[model samples]
Target: MKKTAYQKELAIKATQKREGTDNNKRDVMKIQSWLTLFSMRNPDSGTATGIDGDFGPATERAVKNFQSFNSLTKTGIVDQELFDKLSSNLKEAFEKPLVGNNLRSLMIEVAENHLKQHPFELEIQGQSNSGPWVRSYMDGHDGSPWFWCMGFAQTILDQASSAIDKNFKALMPLTYSCDTVGNTGLEKGLLSRYQKIRRDPSLLKQGDIFLIQKSRLDWTHTGVIIAVEGDVIETVEGNTNHQGSRNGVAVMKRTRSLRRSKIDVFSIEPLV
Candidate 1:
């Protein structure tokens, strides 16, 4: 099976040494970022390396250590095979075939699969949101500007839609901005505003998306509603943490009270 676009980019970059030459600095940064992500995901990989976009001795040592630990020849280089091992975790999470009777179940399953991989954003070269996971979800674009909660939610929707032979973009624009999503929801008549949802919690179902409203026309964050129980809804949101900040570092499960925050629900009922 083919990997995601970011993985293809990494595979291409992995072919070259990317050894801190002025022209190859960005490529080196990507490789180092993937290595760091792999290490963080698999603590035993021993491939922990700083992402400074310079393939120095420390980077080589990390590559060799990972290779040795994984039973590959200790070449101290990041070849295609080595890169494959490094990215296998994400490939498994994203490419695995899912089975579900409906779009809601499929979306929930897709989000859960990603959660299982422990996707976390990284800061490379002093730039936040520059990481393998962020790139994968954000269409190979990652930086401080790419707050990826909407991107992550859209990705999950796309994955489940693909399984069901549906088009996700028809439901919501492919975007990283919560404002764009909330606007699209309003236009499609699929948006349930905070007041309406507060009165009827059942309007928000599992697999629906929740947008954190900042103002009448502004939404700051979004996530997949995995379960709705009474006044507390459990969500699998990206770019958030235990504190549920919109500018968070990882994909996390959080519980939000319906009465506590100004939230809107984007229903998938139209799709079903």
Candidate 2:
């Protein structure tokens, strides 16, 4: 992130200070933003430091964890060395190339992480019906109690791809409907579905999006294909529960066989 004029002025002062020093609030906030970004892109970076620009214990913990990951001393200080490494890592991720299974792997990585944030739900007003997690997939639309399986899938794809600076919408259309994925994938020549009455499940790979037709007009349910077994496939699905209904409760990892008659697979480009 390019620093603002004020932030640049503060940065000069903050650079000379250590953990115990009382740095400028804006400087600390800038560091907080970097800390949050670092954790957002790394799967094992522990809890993200909020970008509130406050130098709190949470920020220190995040700094320590980041330093530990980069093999730097865990002084919990936002020094020049730590800032340099953070800048370098962010640059690398921004410049990271999305090729072959990289996108798929990143999608799977995101799915696995969200799986741990289970019991995720919706709220009416200030309750569970709406929140940041719910709003994420809704694409800034109010996250009411609408069916959100496709929203979940598309949101994760967008976030995971952007983490490495890939254009997820360019790779796959971002829509709240599963049919969009199928249509876009087919139009882009990235979709694969065997013409036979019963297609082989082995043809599906991790990171493929599965669409289950709910009616003649649209495919209603969706999930991310995590792995393909001999006859069945593993999945991480949203708006689903133990029974795997379209209007299910939360995200869950499921194992089920291919219902070729009722399913279509959308494989990302260069993956099929």
Candidate 3:
């Protein structure tokens, strides 16, 4: 399977940052962000570094510590070799090869690939919905108002579509807003309202998109349905945590009760 173009560019940009001289702030920030994310994921990797875009003594020390933890030379430099190790999680999620017989199964496969990477949101300098994963999914956009559940859902679809040599944008526009996706589903006659789905849960197939309906015309969150059993649906979703709030953080595999919250399904049979 071909890697997503956004991550390829991000990987290139990350490798461009060589140490020793005054590094670009944005590049440095990327390095620091990755370091912080790595530390957050692996507590023993190194001390948590700040994403201040400064390659100062603290950042250098953190790099050295990270290198030491990874059993590498403590060079304290963010070189191509070092970046490959630092950003491996991102690469695995967006670049790893996957296979499936069709779009529906392929989307489930793609979503699982990302869930393995444990993507999550970061608050950088008091900015929410901010991080490398969010940026990649949002097409280099992240922050407040960049709620990325829809972006994550679309990215999974995009990767699956690319793998199958199909255009996912034709099924649903590449967007970050849940309302846009829900609206498009309604317009395309792909939306299965909660009322109808409650009566016939079979209408929701694995790999179908789920929109958290706020009312007749608004959706607040989105995710991919991975399984359906009676009133419960298993989902691979982004920007949510244990409580399952729409604004929570992390890429999670969650089980939601269909009878509890209002949800609408967007069928992907059109793509299949």
Candidate 4:
């Protein structure tokens, strides 16, 4: 079916709103994904190659096609107007539940249970006049190494798999190293792993492991998926000392709009 005038206008608005971001490439990928979902509903709206979370030729073409068909400038760029239209159309699609499988939710529950079984002391780092250091458990001695983010995320993924009586080898393998920071195993960038996951949400489950990028340029953080609600994703991360809080886990609610802030998600499924 042909797209209605109202739908075209909405897409234009959404595209316009997506402009001017430090992570323009990531944003473009998200726009493409949203566009793909939109096209799934109004099959004649235009074709999107799907959200690979990367800005490539296919995505550029889709943007231009969408703009031209909507009577908007064919700049091949997504702006607020286009984004708004896409958002409106997607909202309508979401009203119809696709299919709800609880595998992801089940993974989250298992992860939580595992954490309870092997809870450990969480140490907070403090800035000293010389350099950064952790408060010693006994003082007057070198503090212990703080729990690394990758290890923390991996433990949850591993434990969740075990709780469900699944073989760990069958699940996605996770590896962490200092050199991997700012790299997603795809290219050189801080927190590249998380960016890869964000680009492909279809591969993620509720309890998947994720590495959260600390900043647009610095991919130095990690986290886990606590929940997924349509376009909104909730994450539980460690080492963000915010709101007068010390070393512990913190929850962040993110929307599809924040593209530069990437998260690497590793999905796991049980063997039948």
Which numbered prediction scores highest in TM-score against the true structure?
3
Per-residue CA lDDT of model 2 for 1-272, tens digit only, reads: 11111122123254523445667765675566556545656869863655554577888888888888878788888776667565453223223343434777887877777675452444433433343334445544434556778888876676566666666766665567777777787688776654431455566778878887665436878989888776677899888878888877677999876653366777765532
Poorly placed runs, candidate 4 (over 4 Å): 1-103, 114-144, 169-203, 214-218, 241-260, 269-272
In model 1, which regions exceed 4 Å deviation? 1-4, 7-10, 13-26, 42-45
lDDT of 4 by residue, 30-90 (tens): 4664666446445786755655455566777777777776777877666665676645532
- lDDT values, one for every candidate: 0.82, 0.63, 0.84, 0.44
**1-272, model 3: which lDDT tens digit per residue?**
22253563255344333354557777777778888887878898775788888788888988888888888888787777788888888888887888697998988998999999889788888899998888888888889888889888989888888887888888877778889888999999999999999999989899999999999999999999999999999999999989887888899999999999898999988779
Clashes of each: 0, 6, 0, 36
Which candidate number has the best lDDT?
Answer: 3
- Candidate with the larger lDDT of 1 and 3: 3
lDDT for 95 (candidate 2): 33
RMSD of each: 2.7, 8.8, 2.1, 20.5
* Cα TM-score per model: 0.91, 0.57, 0.94, 0.38
The predicted structure with the larger lDDT, 1 or 4, is 1
Q: Considering only N, C-alpha and C atoms within 3 Å, which residue pairs clash in candidate 1?
A: none
Could you tell me which 10 consecutive residues in candidate 2 have the lowest summed lDDT? Answer: 1-10
Better of 1 and 3 by TM-score: 3
